[model samples]
Target: MGADSGFDMVPRLSQGNQDRREWERFLEGVKQYYADDEQVEVGPRVIQFKAGEWPSLPMEGHKFLRFSSKITGATAAKTGVENYIREVQELAKAVFGGRIRPWNELFDVWGFYRWDFVHATMKLHNLVGTPLESPAVWLVLPSRKDIATPEPIPLTSVNNQGNTDLYEVMAIPGRGKGLVAKVDIPKGTQIICEKPLFTLRSSAPPSMHHLVAEKLKLLPNDKQREFLSLHNNFPGQYAFAGIMRTNALPCGPGSSVGGIYSTICLINHSCIPNAHNNWNEEAQHETIHATRNILAGEEILISYANEPSQARQRKLRESFGFQCSCELCSQPLQAIQASDKRRADIEQLDETIGNPVAMMSSPQKSLAACHDLIHVLDQEYGGTVIALLARLYYDAFQICVAHGDQARASVFAERSYMSRVECEGEDSPVTQKVKGLMRDPTKHPSFSAYSTRWRSTRTARPRNVDANSFDKWLWKLSG
Candidate 1:
């Protein structure tokens, strides 16, 4: 082959390009191969390029290759274009020494974009690629500069390390034993990162007794004692399964698996909790963050239930074998009625904010829904509730991103990152993802979903305004 030939121009080593110079030299060599069909475009936060056939892609058929860092679309290997897809995949492997999948495998197989976590959902639903509400409900949200000067949020780790000085575990009046703060704990402080003594795979209740027994046998003598010491709601029946059922916490939100943490499990439940317990995937441990200031000698409580007061009471009784008499549950008749109304509104808004189809078809409306959810949350809790707000802000980020709005997306990501840190600390994988989004919202796989009508660059953010102006810009509210 001639020196100008594409095959000889680039080194095809398995280790891939060793440096930028090598990759650039290789790109120059192969320019002739894709000269006819290729296009390259560089943006403020991302680069996009279309290239020739993939010679060795795993999928059948040939396909055109669009390599991008910010956007993803449903791409399947077509009869003639599979070669391009193969070459792109192999070339990426050759350059980065890893697989580079810009599209979801399931989406590629299904020939549509109905699957995937629906971008930013907390309720976890497979809302189809069709709109749940009228498409015209999508109000055009205005983006104006009305934001306060941005402040930095520092990430901290949960380094409690089983230290007892932060809080002491002791008997409570009627709620058995719980943790009490020995010193004033500030809001957003992650006071504990406790590793689970053992984790249980999703299984049937009949087998849990055997499973728990086997796991208990494997623990150290003291850990085994600690496991046995945990409160068991089931008295006459089986001991191991009852404790496992009553004390085990889900490894993470929406996770079917459960883990038993000796200390975290000991902290009793409250409907109005001062601390938030979250499982950090990156840290492989559970963390408890103070959602609001707690005075010394006060109880450090985390919500074991996340349903409405009535619904949560039912859940708590059925699952954990307890009747909740927390502040919200024991409120005066008029106040209890009001709290339930606000909480029910929150659930509805929460589901609406997570509707992917609604978000894509009417992003402005979804953005407005996010605002409404936060408003209700502020009323119900009176201040920032890190756990709930983190998911909502992330949903807002994805809503902006689906329509190609980067300036607002970045702000939402920043807020989401702060919430993640405050709820799960900096070591969480979710926090890191949000941090990356703050710099380049396009890094999200869902960017430019189906429209770029609201497209704007990161630098397109409005300046010389207070935080309110930024808010108006973000929500597309007019001054």
Candidate 2:
């Protein structure tokens, strides 16, 4: 679970004294990098990569840096084919993380300084302005002429980073950029699953711009550009700090460590969002699920972290540099007050339910509070927040299992398992663990932790009981 203290493996870009030629300094650095290699091909532009397809297509060359390769070389001829072009596409992906960009260029522009990939052609123009800004390996690629390329696909929402068929990441007039649903997305559908572009440890220093730069420096040329393209609210401060503060999500619950995702960061915030995001520990990636039926063209928004309007406003403004006029925040004054009261009640119940003293001294009272909390939540959110519901049911399950009440525990655990599946999916470790508990409540680690006074078999849950009778039996309510 522990990460490196810092990015110590990535090399620092060093400055030279006014004693040697800049070109000589560059060559010396390149030699030092390849010193350990057995074969040193000090030759022309080499497009070296394992090609996937047969029947190579004619590739004249691609322009990189300031060089234009006109004469054909041995290395260039070896790699100047259709398959090598695919390798370039794969390489360009390191920069922007999109498998298929709108321009439809497939160029290996990752390590290149100022490399451009457009229309199946490669050119170096913007980004890192100077070669010194890039690592020593950036100077190693062979020079080649850009040949006439095929037409590229136009820019559209369909050209998203991942299998984002249901939604599109694009420019929003007021919000800078946001994800909008391309289709009517059903509730509980998994929209996105992505690994972090950059995951900073909890031990990061107060001023982490330098470390951010170092991390970017170590990555391929294209990846750096992709990450830097994300919105940065603080113009006056370090870009990484601003972007990280603005877009990074936590690695997990209570994990101070934050991760920046290529597509996830494009999702704008709302106090009452239509989508819910979660980090799965077993998968080592993040996922976003539609909390409700999201209509086509509607912006797919996620709660930065839903809280009281006052807290939400302060955090959004301070951290994200935007005043939230979300549905919950924009509600009329009376309704807003009512909603806040409901939220406050939910928080209070959650705190009390989590208290050991409240569970021990007044177990039945805590169960009643749990029941009341669910009803209040039904009024406020109408079960759209399945993760919250999952947790609430999980708490009730533990309470039953702790007191050795397997029948109610089985029922409660089943609810938790179902709710968890709606959000985290059945494959999720948390969901699977809940499944185990539902099948056999005694398997819960906290089973019989408090007392076994209410012991019963899991089959004690009545099969043919009426709904009204089942409710009384489940909560132990005397009729």
Candidate 3:
């Protein structure tokens, strides 16, 4: 869809110099941001922040230079909120486009500045932080805070219409009455339909705790006994928790403590995951979706995604004392060997792209290689390749700017922003920062003036492109 880029029919201030007093006034508005509690609501219950909630919460490292709020005395024709939004949007463009200098270089640079905003907001909003980095300047909207809640949604159990033995007990090695495919389950089919035995309002810890005493304390006495009776790797009461630790899926928010659902945790791990768990943060829910079809009696599987390489996947599976017989992990020796070679090639390219010396020595070549790897991955796996490509695009943006290619830098910045939105969701810090940078690459304080050395303006388009412009790849929209 097209974006809103048309000029407004209202009078505006000079874009060159934002007066010192004006800057102070903007800062003052930011200081009172928390005071307007009515604008933001959060927490497990989906509470809305009333205007009064602002002052109750602390705001130490939350000061922002840019402020967006309607002036109280704004004319009746335009509400204060509308005027405020317009002012901020225009200011964002001018400052990002180089029409005016930002408050400080550290607070003005895209990556650094965007992180500061996201970090501060996350702290205040009680949102959990993941280990991923964003490439844009993203602001949290009042409407889209759904991904924060760690609770699982109550999903109706899938009916066992075709198979009478839906919950039939079977002696599966390593796991109890496991749910095997009753028939050839098609790709994207729901394999198992089981509810969480009990929902814990805590987050997951960094490692497993297999000691019976540790597990016993967390569950009710009767439930603890039931848990002990379940299939386990350890025989004695001492390592029941440890067996669970080895088997359970780590589910919950980034903070507090995480919980393990007995049923879902026992499905085991597979490199070529037959099932995938998707968490809906805002709704406080999780749903496991099937990736591909499974044969009758096939064991359901899920991936850690921690190990992308086949060798690493084997190592991980072997560490758990089970030889992974999954199709991807158990491919023919030659095919497995070929897959490893592709993984090694991708890794080598990653190291070369990440090398400081290589980046500075021939950044263009490094970026081109990174782009080629991303293209190859996309051809093989579709949209799953976005996360890596997003990071590469952000890296390319920095490289382009360093080499004085503003136009190319701008293009990369936009691609980085869009890719991040798909990978990490729109509310992510990466999206925020990239969006800010994409708005105006040339205005960036770090923008280099040495265009001659960079000389990247040589368009990928041809000079004599009058006829058959449709034949060019640039005209086609990305799918």
- In order of appearance, the predictions have TM-scores of 0.67, 0.65, 0.44
Model 1 score (lDDT): 0.61
Q: Residue-wise lDDT of candidate 1 within 347-452, one digit each (tens)? A: 7997787655577678788889999988888888866466678877888888888789898889888998898888777887777877988999998766876589
Which residue segments of model 3 deviate by more than 4 Å?
Answer: 1-241, 248-259, 262-268, 274-301, 305-310, 375-394, 397-479
C-alpha lDDT (0 to 100) for residue 75 of candidate 3: 34
Ranking by lDDT: 1, 2, 3
Instruction: Report the CA-based lDDT of candidate 2 relative to the real structure.
Output: 0.59
lDDT of each: 0.61, 0.59, 0.44
lDDT of 3 by residue, 163-278 (tens): 23423334566433444666676654544433434333221222233333455687776566545554443334445444453444334322222234444544556555565553
Misplaced by over 4 Å in model 2 are 1-159, 203-207
Residues 6-112, candidate 2: write the lDDT tens digits.
00001111132211232233334344544564332333333222221111111122222222111133433554433333333443333213112211112322332
Misplaced by over 4 Å in model 1 are: 1-161
Work out candidate 2's RMSD over C-alphas. 22.2
In terms of TM-score, the best-performing candidate is 1
